[model samples]
Target: MSRYLLVVPPLAGHVNPSLGLGQALVRAGHEVAWCGPELHLRPLLGAGATVFPTGSRLFRPQSDHGLAAVRSVWDRFIVPYARFSLPAVDKAIAEFRPDALVVDQHCPAGAIAAHRLGLPWATLACSTMDLGDPLAVLPRVHEWVLGRVRHIWDKAGMPADEYFDLRFSPHLVLATTSRELVGRDFPEHFRLVGPLLAERPDQPGFPAGWLRPDRRRVLVSTGTLADDVSARFLRAAVAALAPLGDRLQAVFVAPPAELPDLPEHLLAQARVPMLDLLPHLDLVVSHGGLNTVCESLAHGVPLVVAPIRHDQPINANQVEHAGAGLRIGFARAGAADIRAAVTTVLGDPGFRVAAARVAESFARAGGTGAAVAALARLTESPVTTGPSRSTS
Candidate 1:
């Protein structure tokens, strides 16, 4: 039994996977707590878990990427986030005295703080962006990010030049997705722990019986972070599904009050426990959020991905490459394109087969259970090895 701290950002996508890991760790007889924003975390994590209010608004859910999303993430978000959170994490360290830290890769502040304290930490890769090494091919982009990491080390007042790559952990790096979804070429130091699958904390009463028994059931969501992009896609989706009439029914994740009137066959909700809803769905049309994509695959439900920003385009490309779904341009795809893509996924059995095939891999990856074991091992024997060079 050890006391472990989870350092994370307040973003829903990042926190969701960590929640699964927390749940698994607790069940395994370890004491677990978190460091992030209490306001956003309470509803998701519940009052049982202790949370330290060290989070900053360094993360934006939606960005126009006028500055380019990657550059914005490093320059505007990650660097500033780490700079401000250093003291807060120091306070937590003094009070909690955690044995090890489970840190989200995006929250470099936690990583720097853990390193300064000489505490063992594990880098949790909730998304494929880091594991895939997307920027490695671009020499200039790679150096640019490295330079930012260097600046943060100096600005945060930590031993300058002591830490260069905060994205990786010296002890261990755990990826929540399996090789089946992300492909085999991941950093050797990184362990593929699969998606930390947990039941949605906001499990709303679902109208499972309401789905028309005759029609193909579809789930339409843009994830919580994408309001504007989703609104546009929802409007287009409404038009695309209109022709199906009684042949198809769609349930949307949205604000009921803000949503425009939709067809009778379509229902809008502020939120629903996706884990609860996935079982009833034949197909999912998503904004390519990692949680939604992995959850859909875990249930053997195919997807139709329309990417908006950030890591979504890469995720969409992976889904398309895996033959689990079709990809469409988020901003450019019209109603006709939406309808055709959904129809293609539904009519073809290959898509479902592909999804099922990945589902098997997800189950075998051991998910949170394996993740817990890896983190526990870190405490028993401190890891001195550097990160693995993965070109995949």
Candidate 2:
């Protein structure tokens, strides 16, 4: 059986999309293992996922939002992260020595290491692929991101002087988002198989007894990275939804400290089993995270998005453009605007229709099956079909 090594970054949302595909590969009789951040990622990858530590630093961003965060990401997170994991990834190649590398676009060290070893590798993007395209709409950000990748590739003896879009593989680009959520006109090279809504084994369950059988249930969360601005957003959500009173109930997944102050109308938690909860939720007030957005749509739950940073603004715009939700500014979203948006999504049948439409697309996109087929085709071809070989 051919072994496929997955190179992923530390991000939970990013690694999540790979889970279903890894399971699919395993079921197909191909060996699958992980080479990602150190120890803590083990449990998250689930049982049977043989994971090797990439010797990556535990990078927690000191700045959560704004221009400072952009600078922090470049200087502190991405560049330094690439440096920290470089040797570990190369070591993984020498030790584990898989047939092909299935790499998350965020993990550049793996790509460079694969290039240095002359091994075929496919870029598995669990995030927005458009951000890393050579013809990126945000050219400056593209150049900056490539500059970081070039630094590591140059060190690894690959010619990194030229520009390369590491996000898409020449062999196969397996993306979770389809045209419905991300838009049409994606590069022909990309295989958009819709979102991988891979359910985790352990779900954080809530007190189902607390729900009033008659009320519309809504969920509020910023997904995995909520520590940055949970307080501000949670408060606004409570204020916004308070008027619903006996008519609506909002469940908030937040840190322990942020729970007590929640306006009398909401239930709060450190975390929740989102997949378990989505079916009951009529509306989701989120930070426009790609995973949450897709999951909400998958369950036919409409949304009210407050885009905080990074690709969130883009995803929120998609929700708005799709007529599935309303968008609000994270910091500037007052109680009034939040309430208005929440009411619009919850009260309107059109929003639910749009969300169900997105759900239909996700179903037809074939999730893990589509992704594995693409990988299997690339693996069987035995050609050097990946970024460095194609770009070079």
Candidate 1: minimum summed lDDT over ten consecutive residues — where?
383-392
User: Can you give the lDDT of residue 305 in candidate 1?
Assistant: 98
Off by over 4 Å in 2: 60-68, 129-138, 160-163, 226-228, 261-265, 385-392
* lDDT minimum window of 10 residues, candidate 2: 126-135
C-alpha displacement of 134 in model 1, angstroms? 0.9
> lDDT of candidate 1?
0.82
TM, every model: 0.93, 0.91
Candidate 2, residue 348: CA error in Å? 0.4
lDDT of 2 by residue, 1-392 (tens): 77888888777787777777788888778998888775656666776578888764567655456445555665677667777787778777778878888888777777777665667778877656344352366578767766766665665566645435555566667777767777766666577787776657566678878777788889989766645366777777778887787688888887766657655558888878888888888999998878788888989899999987666777888889988999999988888999888887778899999999988988888888887777777667766534445644
lDDT of each: 0.82, 0.76
TM-score of 2: 0.91
Q: What is the C-alpha lDDT profile of model 1 across 1-392, one tens digit per residue? A: 98888988777889889889999998999988888877777778876778988854635544563228778777667787777777887788789899899999988888887877678899998887666677678789878878887788778766553556888886789987788888766656678877898655656887767877788999889877545666777889888998887678988888776567777888888888788778878999998978889989989999999987777887898899889999998877899999999999999999999999888888898889889998889888864532222222
Best by lDDT: 1
lDDT of 2 at 40: 55
